[model samples]
Target chain A: MKSPLQYRILPLGDHALCIELGEIIDASINQQCIALFHQLKELAIPFIKDIIPAYASVTVVYDVAAIRKEHPSAYGFMKEKLEAMLLRIDTDQPLSHRKIEIPVCYDLSLGIDLQEMSQEKNIAVEEIIRIHTNKTYRVFMIGFLPGFAYMGSVDESIITARRAQPRTTVAAGSVGIAGEQTGIYPLDSPGGWNIIGQTPLKLFDAKRKQPVLLEAGDEIQFVAIDINEFNNYNLG
Target chain B: MSIQVIKQGIADSIQDNGRYGCQHLGINPNGVMDPVAAAAANLLVGNDLNEAVIEMHFPASVFLFKEQSMIAICGADLLAMINDVFVPVNTPIIIEKNCVLQFKKPLSGARAYLAVKGGFELQPWLGSFSTNTKAAAGGFEGRNLKKHDELNFRTVQKYGTALKNKDCEILNWKASVKNFYPASPVIRITRGSEFDWLTEDAKKRLQSDSFIISNQSDRMGYRMKGDALIIQNENQLISTGITKGTIQLLPDGQFIILMADHQTTGGYPKIAHVISADIPALAQMNAGEKIQFKLIEQQEAEDLLFEQQQQLLQLQNAISFPLLKFKQQYAID
Candidate 1:
């Protein structure tokens, strides 16, 4: 049997705690973190507000008043409860990730930085798109903006650095790459990622039951589509 | 029944206790910057503590009440007026129909909160009426109130019947303004996860050196210019969930304090987290203001938060009892 991972639970403030599972970003470590997140969610601990699963850790936010109503001390009660729950998590269980396929239009008109990135990598734009779509990526975390999923470990051949000067505003649905990771800008905001393509799907909608289309453990695949198909895809 | 916006001011939006349980989906908890002031305003109007309120900056929004209603204005003295009559903060005032409420200038803090008796009839997104403008979600149409925009109230009928005879009347009891703000605020903080990463000199300077808030500061964060803090080793932290009041040290050695509309996660080294009790004071800080940080124990921070909550509860009970009795009398008759 594989040995269980060691973790540290540190106080973020009076209302939150950070559980660090590992120091490095690895698939196994991420799985462990996600498992703990699911277990905590299942426990349905009162006063727990948000459970955020990231690259290698999970942060639990709670209401101190609600916790204090049940226990003499809020942090003390939470620490003891979480420590007990941590020991019961079964890391061997298979994690079920929702698979999602995103269609992207790689036409030069939409991808403003394609030519620049191509020149830096000494590769054709078509080959870069092919390399990007060929592999399945894991959703490491969802952050920077609402519904902006940070997916990872892109193909080495297409890797490029972030823009020297970030654009004042990156349009929503713009897919971009930075360092070893790739992500989609769910909203129009200032960003530093190198744009490679554009998608027509709405990644985030507050009206929907699930506001964010992607989650931390979901698997994502990018498929190249023609410019005409991209234009026809209904965003509404 | 509704209020129309005559002119929108800088950064005006509807906010409440904030959207919770959704930060995991990368949505920011964009709420009122000053929760204490927001709650006080709500209490004065006989509304729930988490009810949505209009938050405004200097030269705030000018609104016209289409119907008579009871409302309360709290936080920062924006020199508010009703049809040219001076209005005070932290008190419930009944306004006549068609009366225009305007904020002339800023005499004190940077932000002010306005609460209506029945609370604004806004559609809640993700369990909150707070506006998250970046995503164009929540609050009044996911945007700031614009000219000619109408906002309805939930209990307009009750308010109209209660004060039909008065052109304007201020409530007898008012929220105590003494402890609302301090002349020279000293924020309390606790060491963050990466606090040990800083050099001894840098750690010393963090407490001793004074920092000035930069003009670039907004609801997203407050950037401070002070002595550059040096770390023993140049290390990068994995992007993790960051909460409001997290003090992050940038690669250039400067610091940025995350605020109400802060991003869900950040990669910079988190040097400290301002305690919950002091976040309200920090939020009221204006650009070019100087601030100092004082380190406190974790237990001390918790105790301070508990005490503040207790005080708010007492205030709520004191204000709500009379309102409840009046409603009972009206029902009996």
Candidate 2:
């Protein structure tokens, strides 16, 4: 079976390729990305610094010296290598997704924009909670801040616009929903996202070997917790 | 040997080459804005070019030394003094223990670099001594320098009284500190991705109009004010990879010059990138300076960059080889 996602390996200069995945932010697209990532790792073609996978694309940064060493005078070798491997795309197999239970404290004190969102949506505050918590979010990408995962397809009922102006500082782990998107503030930074809840979980810890608790393709379930449970959940 | 700070400036922090490889995670590389000057200062002190040094913005004052060490001030004419005596720019000065080195207000330029011998040693985070202030990652405690912080200088292979004797005043040195600055505040820029989005008149204004460097500027970005760069289509695109010196055109037609500490990715359409060679000049620009961008071909920019890299490599080689030979032949007696 052919894969749902088709990627065009666009050469960026001599040392990089922008893996442009066709539009569609879904599970099938994610599977193709995960498969490609695993395939590159298994091949272990040298000179690659990293494969930075985003929502619908992955950019591979490579060392020029290594590329030249591996494919002497072959200008188009990298592109050819990537194209040849696309035929072997494992479509049948679905990669295992990790379940990350994010304990969120929905305290209005911490959730700075909860009341505003609740009022704007013309829904009860409790209904907002139910709609937000009921769905399992697919971690499409991680960006903007360190370890900040961009998970998506929040219910249309909870669609809310960002504040006209961003807050000067959004504390780390502050959960926010903007329009149809939902994400966590991975670091204490100036942000414009509509913060509705806060997770006490340390989503990003520089001291940790992996640093980021969740990666792309992981499933996230926001479990509403009391202040006691939030305080109990250790922040890295 | 350790160097003690007698007075920390308005903003001073330990910086090296920079922490790379983590930009994808949105970690800003908070290194010396003027990397060229930082490297020069490092070279003046007989340290490896990429070693850590103090990156001082205007209003910096400090006292630090290592083993009766020498230091060089490479960027900004910030009225720097060694024990109340004026220390000339671009030259190495010997400062014994207890001697005070104060950096006065900026006579010209914004940032100044201070490099001590053997480089300042700080615990590195994520394979670099450079600090990421936004992420609070590298350098001393991952923050700006405060009053009375001690910086350690690592030991280096002994090279006696060689570079120190050659030039007493840095102005007389053969280093190409001149011809670096453009005639005016003219910054060369290439066409941005959304250059076409601008109307004919707007595009003409962009090429001709003068934009004042707004005071609403910092490590993150250099905000420019003057001509509102209104676009024909104000579509918000998905944020993507951004780099230092990227001129991002906002919907309002204002420009944000991304600096060293700018976000890794941005959604704004980039107008043009400030050439790598001109980045050092941009780093030293004080607020309220009037600036204009002149379009140059990408090939020309690349060629200029290649030449600059070649020249820097030559300088590195000169200090490493010929100077080492000169020291060996002349200093033995």
Candidate 3:
């Protein structure tokens, strides 16, 4: 129960725990990763404060009092427990998958950078619209901001790097592309991603029962709407 | 009652202890930079620890009613004056209405705190009166006080006896202010989660090196320039909850120390976290001044924090305010 995979858990200062996941950024391994995450959730140690999952690694935070009971140093104790968990990985079982459809408005007024992106890609604006609405993108992780989902494996044709300088403000629900990753802005924050469109749907709402609309391992598809429909979409 | 902001030097805002327990909502706990000084100022004026106080960056002087009322100023010696007469720092003073308070250029330190009795009465948002300028929430209508804005205070009938003898006994009370603030720029820190990820050379530099605070700094985070701390393991980090004093390693190898208005979550590798007790020292640091970190064991850090808490409790008991005693008794009844 303690060991999950060949994960090297290193102690980060006194409060944080870092698990070095080598350097693989494949989306296929998330199934095993999420299953292990569920296992850890079930075991539920008291000292654990929070677990943050990224593309290839997960960092766990814990209290010192609960960590030092069995071991002398928090570093040694966390590493041992994590190494043990890695050894007992149940690879046969798969993680659960969730489907989340997001509503997007491809209007030129709302989608500030779509025309520019279409021009850069040398594709017609309608083709850019069709390709964007066509695929089901998998969420790789959530990072940068609260409820900000990193959904990716975008089409090679649409692959683009971030802007040279980040914009001072990217409106909330802005669907942007940075490198190969496509994500929706959960908050009105400064960002460098190339914005393609905007979603009327709230990616993250503090008032909602579940703040984040999509978690890691969820499948998503963007459905386009006209400007009138986007304007009428209930923000609340 | 509140004094109008005739001259808002550098930056001034109403802050309490801080707005905690809101990280999950992506809101940073915007509060006082030097909580020790803020709490001390509050103590001098017989206010609760969480009472709202004005945090003045550099110098802040105001024009208010000159009537006798308990007020305390702490942090940087901003050559403060009341009606052209010099007012001692750290000591609670009673002044008459129409007295003008002006702060000279800060001789030392970056910020100062002014706490009044009964605390400033302001509407709180999300259960806190703290102003988070980034989110544009809380404090004085969700922003800093402007010219001609007069804030009202919560009325308290119980006045400290020290209020009566403010003129004659001011010098002796000022001595009490020297105990908490030290002259040195050394701040104690606990090793961060990614401390080992740093190269041994970087780790040594961190221990022995002196850092200069950059000018492009704000309440959100302080960008510092020093020896680049290279991370040996260049793995991507997941975004997680970050607290005040969190030292994040940016992509450029620069150190960004999270302060009161830092982001709720971040993905950068946290190299170290300054102990909560030493944050006051960090708050006092001036831009371009040399600062160094003193490494301490986690246990020692925790112990120092507990000791500081004890000292605060002791200070609270030392006040001979009869009304405070009566109020405590009243609460019990």
Candidate 4:
């Protein structure tokens, strides 16, 4: 048995509705969102187009034309079905997790903001790397770019804000931190996150059997590797 | 029949209805910007509404059809021409072997859609033929159509009727786009989740003011500039799920409406969302164009969408019935 959660259903266009379970990004709230995500998928509502789970919400994107066939109001019917499902859902159980180890190189040459971040925070570069790699982070979401995993709760010591001036182009495999979260750039794109390191491993490969290396609800841990090791990982 | 790209004009790529069910993984649905135009083009050529179509921007690609083929050009009146002759949009036309098709100038709108009969022979990436340029997956080697690129036909051609003209023959019927696209159209929007965060004055400005689409816009999102919207709260929002047509207020006081290739999640305060029915018109609107928003109820938006879908169904029946009869009488297969 689990405590009933207080949530609000917000309208997101005519075809979709977002159920916000909580306001902030918390581990338990995210776990509940993940649990709800699986439940929504299991129901396999034919009208549902996409079920996207973020930090504290799970947005149900539905097909308006299909839902219109059965219900006069598309959002209303989905909301009713979802509310019924929520009554039977149990979020007390621990969320299913898959641990993934990612090797990263914190070399100053590759990590363009490593020295700047260290100087700004008054922490040694090695200490910053140690702080980043010391704990396992929960994958709250995968978004912004394909295969880009948004993981959370970086060590409080190194909690940093997004750069006021975002880089025009951040290289792929760049490890970045913004506020209490951390993530890798799956593709080279315009970004504002403070990059702390780089990884040689391909975060996204369309040709690979499994395109994305990480997914939401994953347990991701960073392992510090020398630049040489990073290069070797790319080769292998 | 396959098309050989003679001129690769801008970043023209292949697109379909859209790629869905992968937003959770951060992959966007990079389909045709103008769904009405694309669907009409596909239907005009006797293909499914969501079949892969060549989405072009002016100066669009000049393609040489390797064999006789029937095709339709829709969306953005780019003044499409077959050799020296003019070709109007929303009409299916049959081109003789080796005839080169080209768009000379932009008469109206922006992106143009060209869909071939029997569809193109291409493997779908994650169940869609839409190109993901950033990810470099799907739609003709996961990239835009380029010079010398040949798109093989998925099925062999077998048209029973013979063409009267040698170069090309224009079909009599045409699909009307009056309901889909209008001149000087007013876009409709619904208040976003963070709509109340806007100051009272700013809220009024959004509906009353006219914004110009910035040059920095693309399929990902449209950056608009006009009245600088001011928010009462200067709070940093946690990243949340975002959908196509979401209008987010930028830190610089401008606005950016997320489009087809929008990220699955965003941290900015969402001020409003463009009603889905108006998206077809929005997609056809080009940079340097003026746009205004009209706030409407959610029920009205849904009603408008349902009506649009109903119209599309009617179009499908109208287009396919004659096509099926023609094929029955003429198809040698």
lDDT of 1 by residue, B34-139 (tens): 9999999999878889999999998799999998778889888899999978989988888988989999889888889999888988788988999999878889
Model 3 bad stretches (over 4 Å): A1-101, A119-123, A135-157, A186-188, A200-221, A231-236, B61-68, B156-182, B231-234, B320-333
- Model 4 misplaced regions, further than 4 Å: B158-161
- Is model 4 an incorrect, acceptable, medium or high docking prediction? high
**Native A-B interface contacts kept, per candidate:** 0.62, 0.16, 0.14, 0.83
Best by lDDT: 4
Give lDDT tens digits, candidate 2, residues A15-57: 3455766445666665566556656766877666556566556
Give the C-alpha lDDT of model 3: 0.72
Measured against the true two-chain complex, the DockQ scores of the candidates, in the order shown, are: 0.75, 0.31, 0.23, 0.84
Query: Best-fitting candidate, measured by TM-score?
Result: 4
Ranking by DockQ: 4, 1, 2, 3
Estimate the overall C-alpha local distance difference test score of candidate 1.
Answer: 0.87
What digit string (tens of lDDT, one per residue) describes model 4 on residues A129-203? 999999999999988889999998898899999999999999999999998899999999899998988998889
Per residue, candidate 2 scores C-alpha lDDT tens digits across B64-128 of: 55445557788887888766578777766656555577876678778888887667667788888
Backbone clash pairs for candidate 2 read B192-B271, B229-B253
DockQ of candidate 4 relative to the true structure: 0.84
What local distance difference test score does each model get?
A: 0.87, 0.72, 0.72, 0.88
Tell me how far the alpha carbon of residue A139 in candidate 1 is from the true structure, in angstroms, after superposition: 0.6
DockQ value of candidate 3 = 0.23
Cand. 1 TM to true fold: 0.96
TM-score of chain B of each: 0.95, 0.90, 0.90, 0.97
